[model samples]
Target: MRLSMPWFVRLAVIVVFATGLQAAPAPALAGSDQPPGMIAAVVARVRDSVMRIVVVHPPEAPPGEKTMAKAGEGHPVTRIGSGFVIDPDGLVATNRHVVENATAIFVATPDGGRFRAEIVGMPHKADIALLRIHTGYKLPAIKWGNSDALRPGDTVIAIGSPFGFDNTVTAGIVSSVNRDIMETPFDDYIQTDAAINHGNSGGPLFNINGEVVGMNSVLYAPGTYSGSVGLGFAIPSNDLRFVLSRLEEYGQVRAGMLPFRTQSVTAMMAEAIGSPAPGGALIAALGPRGDEMNGLIQPGDVIRTFNGEVVTDPRDLARKAARAPIGSTVRLGICRSGTIMAVNVPILAYDPHPQPIQEPGPPPKMLGLQFSAAEGSDGTIRGVAVSAIDPTGSAADSGLQTGDIILRVQQQPISTPEQARAALQARAAAKQPYAAVLVERNEKRTWIPVALPGE
Candidate 1:
């Protein structure tokens, strides 16, 4: 039931994944034209490794609850996604979002076998999940591809369950690489024209040789549109491989961190910094450890290179730092006061389960509202009480009622009423037909889709 509305709270469509190179010319098969065995051969080779996942959650499970009530608490909510076999011992790979909230998971293969699957491991930050099923015999697994070698216009093939249609194949070229849709601090996504739909979230995006190049993950479309608009994104296989390795070995993914908070240098900033062109990552802010690095790499210093490699931007530095070998000191080329210099900084592994920082929470920020959407000066809406519901309105039709309180819209806390209004308005203006809403009623919370009114 949780079709993740990630960076697309503005554009309202569900996502799908796909990629494949055009097949080489050969003898025509039964079907007909196009190239001989292009897409067909690739699909035939790897389709069996693809998986169909059926997840059952407690109907009353709050949205995004990682662990839910064991199945059969109430009417179970069934949601479907896709995955692929990664190991012959029944290990599977999938998007983290697919099974994050699942109470019960079922995996089906092309050979007519269905088995219960359990979460083997998953990274805290990346959208990658690993599952393991106990199959008596060896299961077919996919061959890994080099995502770093992918280029714009390279072909790709995707296999998944779109709308519960299992093993569905779609192909498209790489639209671009290293896309930053802001999903995470490490946001290098492979943009593709593959038809990734609502149910294609965790499937495999294959190259022409039947090797898995990426995992179908996110998509872009009009808010009201139900189909992919040839704009889909996938987690690159190299990143996926790294996360999987960390998850299996460490029980979590580890990322390397430099001491200071940074942002990309802009043209104006470059001019002020006396640079020839706009480039390099600029240290904009500092944390505690950043204070330590600040002495050597002060604020306003542009990181021109990392370990002798040219640093393109903030994201490039992030990726390089995250994937850098642990305990290794890397050289940072920095420009400060218009002078270039080098400093060796030890890569720091981020603590995944550190004690929660005691936030500025002495006086809990509150907004006045048992009915009206009263919000604090900081723009956080406490609990917007639904004073009344129009019987014929979309909320009412979605089973919302008077006295119900709105908790979040699209996984984000409604900041101010105006921000909430504008976000919904933008989705409506973009012709997005529905808004995913979280509501509390009778002291319980649940997610529901509220249809936005037509223009």
Candidate 2:
């Protein structure tokens, strides 16, 4: 007996057969044109290492209460996210926002086994966090790939639990690299078209070689919609490796501060400064208490390199500075008056809270500027107000006007002329070339590089 099939059904069958044949070609003896099963093999290799993290948060306290209720006592709030094992000893990495304020964390494996996790360390500046789970045995871990070597259009796979669905796999190409989403100061995200969603936070972004290259962290959604629009961002594995190293050594990440504010060099500013290209970071303002006393880096100077690494812009300088060892000295390549010069500056540990400056005694007459305590409208001391300027002195040449208020010298507040003189004398005693002065003019604050006069 003969049977007839519908035209649409026959077409669908033919398409399916052709796709299957393309996906999995028959085994050939020699010199056959057949595609390798790369994606399938990659998924099989790394899917078992991905984990679903469930966090139980402590209950909120009553209004106006000083303390929160203890964990496991109040109503439980649960949060779910994804993570991956990075070490065989059960070291897992995830987003800090995932386990933030979590009283208890649980990790679920692919084989229906659950284990308790302990928070190892979480860096404040970066969104990465490390956790340790005691599985009582060695767990499968993923190998790290070089995110810096990734080019646009490289094949990548994302494995995570999207919306509580476990082990969801998606594949796409790298859309871009070194993307700054403006979410954090250290934003060097690897942009991909991988399908990442709410529960996919902290999942592993894998390369074609089954190596972890990035950590899926965020996605861009259109207005009023909370789904991925093919714009997914992952924290590059290179930055994550740095954070992990710091966490292992110090239990927290410690970044070195350059003690200065910088702005991206524009084409107009570059021309004004006689720079051939607009790629360096321009020194906009010196920190109130930075290492600018050596006169190495100054206002109007452009930074082109840090420790022999080329600085493309302000963010590059910041990233390089933050990675440097605290209290260690590094050389900075700077451009001044169209001349390239190198200056060695010591990196200082970042201080979130700085001490307030106190008033000093009588003023010295060495410098050619007169300073007095200025008062606000309510009669409060504002700063050391500049009363006079010597026209032929370095202060006047550096654009110090009479009405400008001397707020700080070398980043320390100056309440009296004596303090300003002392700072200047210290710089001179150290044989420093210039002193960074913070001046308030017309309700705006600016940093001026004043050349110290020879004794």
TM-score of 2: 0.67
User: What is candidate 1's lDDT per residue for 210-316, written digit by digit as tens?
Assistant: 89999998778776565677788898999988888776776567678786777878899898987556888988877677654537777788999999999888888
Q: After superposition, how far is residue 98 of candidate 2 from its true place, in Å?
A: 0.4
TM-score of each predicted structure versus truth: 0.69, 0.67
RMSD of each: 16.7, 27.7
> On residues 1-455, what C-alpha lDDT tens digit does candidate 2 reach at each position?
00021110000000011122212232131112224677778999999999988765444567987544332233434567899999989899988777766555668788866666777777666777888878778889999999999998788889887767788888778889988766654567899887677788889999988999999987776555666667888989888888887877766778777878888898999999977789888988888865544767788889998989888888778878888988899999999879999999988776454322111111212445667778888999877877765432334334576667888889797888789888877987887657889999999999987656545
Candidate 1: deviation at residue 317, Å? 1.0
Best by TM-score: 1
* Stretches of candidate 1 exceeding 4 Å from the true structure: 1-34, 61-73, 354-455
